[model samples]
Each structure stands twice: as C-alpha cells, then as structure tokens.
Target: MLNRSGNTKYQIKDAQQVYRQLSVSYEKIDSTSKKLVAFADKCPNIDENDISSKARYATLCRNIRMYAVQVLQNFSLSTRRVPTEDEIKQARDAKQRSDNELMEKVILSIPGINGKTLELSEELKPFIQQYYQVLQYMQQAKLAGRDDEVKLLESNLEELAQAMRVAHQN
Candidate 1:
C-alpha cells in the first residue's frame, strides 16, 4: 500500500487532472455559446418555419443550457467546502458581468446588423434571462452543499434542453 504522503500526492494529481479537463470543457462551452449568440444576431430575420433557422435556434438554446450545466459542475468540483453568502453573491455578479461583456462583444463584432441583432436579442431575452437565473440558483445550491437541490435544478435544465431539441425536430 502507498504511504500517506504518496496517497495524498496521487489524489492531488488526480484532482489537478480533473480541473484541467473541466477548464477545457468550460472554454469550449464558452466559445460555442458566443458563436451561437453571434449567429442569432446575424440572422435575426430568419424565417421561423425554415428548417435551418429552427435548427440553429435550437442549437443556440441547447448550447446555453450546456454551458450552464458545465459551470455548475465545475463549481461543485472546485469548492472544498460550503461558501459564504458573500462569496456566492460575488460569483453570481462576476458571471453576469462576464456574460454582459460577451454580449457586447458579439453585438459590436457584426456591423450593420443592429436591427437584426436587436430583434434577435429581444426575442431571446426571456429564454436567456431564465437560463441565467436557473444557473445562479444552481451555483447557490452547489456552494451550499445541497446536492438534492442541484439534482432538481439539473432536471429543470434537462427539460429545457429537451424542449429545445424537440422544437427543432425534423
């Protein structure tokens, strides 16, 4: 059997590996979320009945949910103990700020798409707001060590994912 120090070292290495994987996953999800939002902005006037438009919209919604889930999972893994209320609030604020900056960048990146971008942003506002709200709740639950609440929130997210998938079914 390994000595206590050797065992601890192995555990630390395993955790570092998991952290790296989670970081990579978060980056991919963030990139996909930004691309989807950009696509929405560029195609604001897309015909709802068009198969491609429906597929793209569904994909965007799915990506948002996927990003939220990954973020919650990452938080759950990274935190060693329950966080204070202040910490939770700080995390929530930071995430919102980051999201707003991303939105601004996405909007500014495509010139002459203002009207379309506005329309798309307006149409998606409810969904986007609700998704983020759920994500915030998930973060709180995870930080509080409420596994049951986390599972419930995950179920809600999965339902949102299913709705998006069904909306684009051919």
Candidate 2:
C-alpha cells in the first residue's frame, strides 16, 4: 500500500541498518580471529588430552582455515570493494610490466626494420609506428578476403620474428 518512493526509502533505511550491523560484526570477527589464533597457538596441539573437547577441535579448525586464508591471499573483512595497498601495488607493477614488454617489442622491431639503434631512444610512437602500420595493413588485407596478401604478410611477419630473434641475441 506504500508509494514507490516511500518503499524505496524504507528499503534504503533497512539496507543501511544491515550494513551497520555487518560492520560491527566484522569488527568482532576480526578481534575474535586474532584472539582465537593467539589462544590456539598457546594450546598444545600434540598432547593426548590438550584439545580433547569438541569446542577446542572447532577452534582448531577455525584457526587452520584462517591460517590458510592468510597464507593464500591478502584477506579483507570488508564486504564492499575496497582496494588495499597491496592491490594498488600489484596494479602498478602489472602496468609497468606491460610497458616494459611494449618497449622491448619496439626496440626489437626497430632493429628488424633497419632503423638506427641510438643511445638516446626516440618516443614510443615513432619506434612502434612502422610495426603497427604493417600489422594494421595485414589485418585489413585478411578482412578484405585477400588470402594471397594475407599469406604474404604472414610470411613477412614470420621473417620479422626471426629478425627480431637475431636482434635480441645481439
């Protein structure tokens, strides 16, 4: 019987309350996990009657599961998408690796095309221009139903790969 806007507002209020409760629960879980691990570490795992009770066995299982999580990944308690510092570093590292690969390609392509290998390298655009142009033309040739041209370009690319290999060795 409520209006659409009123229902939406009520749902939003309910969601907010649920989120608050989840936040509080996460804090408790985080604290309990730490304390439980400490307590488990103190308990004798090998003794005959050390972890005899069901509750102690349950604690051991929880401790092992948490240990696995800690070892396997950067664990987070937040339900939302929160970027941790490690995640940011990983993203930056991946981008740097990609850039390094592209630069290596440009360097190899230049030597293959008989371009100058100068001490001070030029910009990425000029270095990769000819390589991209040839690649683009080859793709267009294939799409235009030019099988002969495609075959020719494929062989040319193979030759280029060999040349790049030679250049890489040097």
Question: Residue 9 in candidate 1 has what lDDT?
Answer: 36
Scored by lDDT, the top model is 1
Per-residue lDDT value at 22 in model 1: 69
Q: Model 1: runs farther than 4 Å from truth?
A: 1-121, 165-170
What is the model-wide C-alpha lDDT for candidate 2? Answer: 0.60
Model 2 per-residue lDDT tens digits across residues 44-152: 5556565566457667858766875564334344355445567768999999788667655655555344434523244434435445566778989988999999888
lDDT of 1 by residue, 1-170 (tens): 37866763334446666777867877677777767666764566678669787677767766786777678677768756545567768999999888876555443333333423343344444444555566679999999999999999878766654443333232
TM-score of every prediction relative to native = 0.29, 0.31
Deviation of model 1 at 24, angstroms: 61
